[model samples]
Target: MMGKTLVLVTGMVTLLSACTMMDQPKSLAFRHNAVTADPQAAGTAQVTTRPDGMVTTTLVLTGLTPGKTYAAHYHAFGPDSSTDPCASNGPVSVGFPSFTADASGRATTSVSSEMARIAGDLGAYINVHYADDLKVVPVCAPIKMTKG
Candidate 1:
């Protein structure tokens, strides 16, 4: 009887430990918009989480004019998808460095953070600059990030 009781308790503990291990949270994926002034010069970004919690962002820029520099950042919300740009309700959990564009009109970057925190929500987009006007002429919005 004593041996049986010990076995049962051990089994229960092992089962509980397995359950806890399965409950560990995973990283998240992100959707981003590339904003530019040339209606043709914009696109989206897809961010995926790696096992080490670093995020790799794959950016696709279309309609680019070639040989132009763009001042970009991970903004908080999806463009008109939200009411304000600086508001806290959008997706950008943390801000990234300003990026430039190449002749083919594409650029990619990554971040090493959990990206799941409220500070890392980074909900929406990528903004590109036009060489002629030197102002942000395009805006992309409504990007999404989900647990992978």
Candidate 2:
């Protein structure tokens, strides 16, 4: 009887642990295109909600111009409902600080904003433009939300 009770307790503990793991935040991936066929740059971003209700995002990217500063922002979905491609992503939802690539052409930055989590905001995107000219969007990525 004691052995059966122990097994049941262990199973219950395992189930509870799994439930907690499911509550953990998720990360999203973004890939940039030089044109429509060539992959230019890529980035990964994760959104975590703090206990204070502030949402924080950490973004890391590679394949940028060395020693160049770039402007990054979060944009809403475009008018087209079928797709949220980078080229048509709507107005800026959140503007992040400018990032300067290292000599190796890599950058990592963490910014805190009121932007919602992936589950909460499925129509948002991360856009990276030339720092000198915000009008030129060289590389951009749609924030694809996923679960663990």
Candidate 3:
């Protein structure tokens, strides 16, 4: 019994160590949508690729209108502009769950998507919009900087 317990413990530790040793993904920074600036909006997007190749992205935000509803999505390179993915007016590739800012003007939301959905030029950027009025965008995080 002691020998069996020792092996089980060692296996658990090895599994945990392997998980921690996995590569850390780089975070995508959100910037004020220059075309339609929201002086008080900022955030970061982090994408993590799982062992099976599915990717999950979490968006962490600050400086939004308190209690307001917002929507966000991963977008493909649009027809508007090639150089700036954020300004390209892309179509939604994957949408995150709608979220609302807290009393402190901060929010966090996440979405899990298949790697193929956001691969290459398909997932060019992520944009945050007002849930009540989609025309208003406060921040954008560029993923694929250049579109081919």
Candidate 4:
């Protein structure tokens, strides 16, 4: 009888532990694309999990004018026709990086650690510069990530 009780108790403890662990939030993989009005200019981004519970993203922009500079950030929403969605949520702009185009009009950069923690209703995109301001752009809002 004692052995049976011990086995049942052990099983119950094990089950409870498993349930607790399952409740934890999971790491995620995120991806997005940049589509500009100028079909010749567009980009794609892929983010992977890192060991430190952060995400590292690799972005590639193609069909751009070579030797140009681009200012990139994770915006608040996908392609909004009206205003910059990120302007109101200043926190979203933290840890963004700037990338310069190569002779082939391709650029690459990684998203910063702070930016990786952004959750729920967030999007990412790149803006291609024409003059001092952004001329053509591609935006992906409501970025999705996978949970484990």
Q: Which candidate leads in TM-score?
A: 3
- Cα-based lDDT for every prediction: 0.48, 0.68, 0.90, 0.50
TM-scores, all models, native as reference: 0.48, 0.70, 0.83, 0.53
Model 1 C-alpha lDDT per residue in residues 1-148, reported as the tens digit of each score: 9999999999999998866654353332222224434555546555565556555554556555566655444555543434334322334454444455667766544444455542333544444334345344464433433311
Arrange candidates by lDDT, highest first: which order?
3, 2, 4, 1
- Residue lDDT tens for model 2, 1-148: 9999999999999998876655466587876655542145677877766656566777788877888888888776555443544655466777779989898888887777654532234336777777897776756666643211
Candidate maximizing lDDT:
3
- Model 1 scores a C-alpha lDDT of 0.48
Worst 10 residues of 3 by lDDT: 17-26
lDDT of 4: 0.50
What are the per-residue Cα lDDT tens digits for candidate 3 across 1-148? 9999999999999998877655466699999975553578998998888888789899999999899999999999999999999999999999999999999999999999999999898899999999999888999999988886
Ten contiguous residues with the weakest lDDT in model 2: 114-123
Segments in model 3 whose C-alpha atoms lie over 4 Å from true places: 1-23, 35-37
The lDDT of model 2 is 0.68
Candidate 4 on 81-125: residue-level lDDT in tens? Answer: 324442233224334466777888777776745434554434432
**Model 2 TM-score on a 0 to 1 scale:** 0.70
